[model samples]
Target: MHPFVSVVIPAKNEQGNIGLLIKEISEVLHALGNIQFEVVLVNDGSKDNTVIEAKEFAAQSQCQLQVISHEASCGQSTALHTGIFHAKGEWIVTSDADGQNDPADIPALLQAAQQVQTEHFCIAGFRNKRLDTPWVRLQSKIANGIRQRFLNDGVPDSGCGLKVFPKRTFQALPYFDHMHRFLPALIKRINGKIVVCPVNHRNRAVGQSNYTAWSRAWVGVVDMFGVMWLRKRTKLPRIISEEIE
Candidate 1:
């Protein structure tokens, strides 16, 4: 039987966090009671023992687990693409492997998505109180402000990795490098609804983050303009009625 939801996590050199995060995910999903779910862990070519640790924990996990690996380190977007495309679930929930995104909040995201009446929608997590360094928080604040102004995506914390949406809705979006960062905007461009939900955030207790503030800022600048172009050119017709013979 296919899983109802698949929690896709992209990890690189997150050995200390992967196993623990998987365990937490399993526990939370099991508590949902009769909600079939699986964890699709995409090891983004980690030089560490992330894959090994994940497999070890999967042995005792209550929910199903699938691990995919890239021969070399691909970016988070590519890892997410790999996992989501391979996931067997109808709904896809993505979370950071750093353990900052609480697995317990998965229920909240799922509940938010369930309440949405639209067939195509995205539930983006809003971190009201970020637990990052002051400098990093400032960078995010500025970047988010600019992105909102340009894309008008209405997502306060688009960088937050915790998001819930249907697998089909995600598959409909055009994929590109760093596409993960602009999900809300892309979804909106394609005429999909966007829902924002507040979720818990925690400080990293394990490995360091892969990308620095400067790196994110530079890439975000280029990606933001690219998305703006895509939005302007995208023309979705409003179908008043459709009848299939």
Candidate 2:
């Protein structure tokens, strides 16, 4: 039988962090009990031993686990897209491989998603106490403010890596580079609601940061404008009538 949930992690040169994150996720899910889940780890051309570590964990994991590899480094958006494409679960849970997002919060997201009556919606994690450098936090704050103002996504922290959503809902959205950062906005464009939940955040215990302030500013500006354009051009019908059987 197919799993009920698929947790997708996009790892790029995260050899030190991937294994522990995966193991934590497994333990949390197992403790929750009675929920069949699978872990989909995407190795986005990591130079380190990420693949080896992931494979080793998968071998010993109680729940099903699969690893997908990219020959060259693709952006996070592409890596996530690949993982979603190959996932065989009704619900998709995504988190970064850097261990900043706590695996313990997965149950909260799942519970929120389940308790809501709305079917086509997502539960996104919001880090109340972010564990990042002050400068990085400032940049994120400014960017998030701009995104919320322009896109009206109603999500305060779109940059949060932890989210739980239906697989089909994600499949309906248009794909693009850096699309992961714009999920709340994009999901809103499709007339879907997003529920933001406060989740635990931790400092990265291993590896260095992959993104710098300048690089984030440069690409974030471009992507912000592009997403704004998409939002402006998006048109969803208020109501649809169909023949009843």
Candidate 3:
């Protein structure tokens, strides 16, 4: 049997884009055919009508659509956590709900994950072909370069908004603010082999990003330093004894 795939979307103020995103996923992939899938949308306290439209989409979608809302606006990492927690599918696929991450590219990621026996664990996505503002792209390049130099992890595009992973893998990783940025490296820490493929990136159609360019740059400083701290603090668990607590 094909493993169930959960399509997790993180939305802030994407009222216009959320409905379209759901429709696209249903048409392209998430319709319940040979494989089972679910669309889990985490509305991070959008001031717009995002939640209402998302709920309507859930009512009609062929794939079970679930809407989770945050009482107040939290970061994207929190939204990620909420979606993953609600995901019942064995394989979890996360994408940006701002229309930047194409639903059509999901098949490619799924195929790559399955090829590598992803039932155990794997995070797959694009290494190149990212579409965004020149400044956004440049910022990502500098951030990724710094991460690669410090972490020595060979993730090409860690900032790409599209990723596929086994739900179990997510269960194993430690949670941190902006942890989404270091998914590839975190996966490696738990002995997971992260895979990369080319995924289509589209321009934003609706709401603007919640984060500013300068804040993104500043967060990189904190995140990089924190990651370095984690590297030092990590200790391998030893099998002391098999006694129940």
Candidate 4:
């Protein structure tokens, strides 16, 4: 049997981009013709036609597709959890539903993960040239730097929103509001490894960005501390409570 990969996309209101992204991903993966893949789209309370568009795409695609819905807008992290939990593949890859992450870059990420020779390793896409606004870029750079400095993970683009991990490992992550932004550190808490690959990024063709500068700063403040707490609170087990003679 071919190794299965699940492509998970979390969308809030990305009607314009989701359809094109779906087509592009299908084309690129079909050309590869080696790995079997499925797509799991998480529609996180979209008030737009996003779900309708995704359903249409699913109906037409040769690759298996499924949509998970959230009645209310929880957040991207929650949507990610929903998608991964629904995924039926050995490997899980997540990309922004807004079309910023290009499908052409996935092969490099998968190849890098293979080279590391560890099932515990995650493949992260480090944007070669970020297409987000300057302010968003600054916040991302700051968050990643702070995480790397304190967490020793050396991940420079934790907020890139393009990554791949074993479905089992990803599902094991502790839940949080913005866990998507700190996957590298969360993985490290359990001694997991991550590999970074420079990936292509494109400017959004439609739909306003879901993140705002102020919201980012506020959330960053809380998430940074939360990660620190997780780091400090984690303890290695040193004893066996019982042994059979």
- Candidate 1 residue pairs in backbone clash: none
lDDT by residue (1-245, candidate 3, tens digit) is 45898989989989888888888888777443578888999989888999888777766765588788899888888899989999999888999888888888887788778777433455556647666778888988888788889886567777777888888988888888888878777777766777777878788887788888778778877887887777777776868779777
Better of 1 and 3 by lDDT: 1
Off by over 4 Å in 4: 237-245
Worst 10 residues of 3 by lDDT: 118-127
Task: In candidate 4, list every pair of residues with a backbone clash.
Answer: none
Q: Which candidate has the highest TM-score of all?
A: 1
Instruction: Estimate the lDDT of model 4.
Output: 0.83
Encode model 2's per-residue lDDT on 1-245: one tens digit a residue.
22399999999999878888888999999887778889999989888999898878767776588889999989899999999999988999999999999999999899888876665788999998998889888988998888777778888888789999999999989999999988888888887888999999998879887767678777988998898998889887766677779
- The TM-score that candidate 2 achieves is 0.94
Tell me the tens digit of each residue's lDDT in model 4 across 1-245. Answer: 33688999999999989988988888888887898998899999999999888778766767578889999888888899999988998888899998889999987777776676555768888886887778778877776677677766767887788898888778667888888878887887766788888999898889787877678667877887898889889875867697889
TM-scores of the models, in the given order? 0.96, 0.94, 0.90, 0.91
- Per-model C-alpha lDDT, please? 0.91, 0.88, 0.80, 0.83
Candidates ranked, most accurate by lDDT first: 1, 2, 4, 3
- How accurate locally is residue 79 in candidate 2, as Cα lDDT from 0 to 100? 95
Position 202, candidate 2: lDDT: 92
List the candidate numbers ranked by TM-score, top first: 1, 2, 4, 3
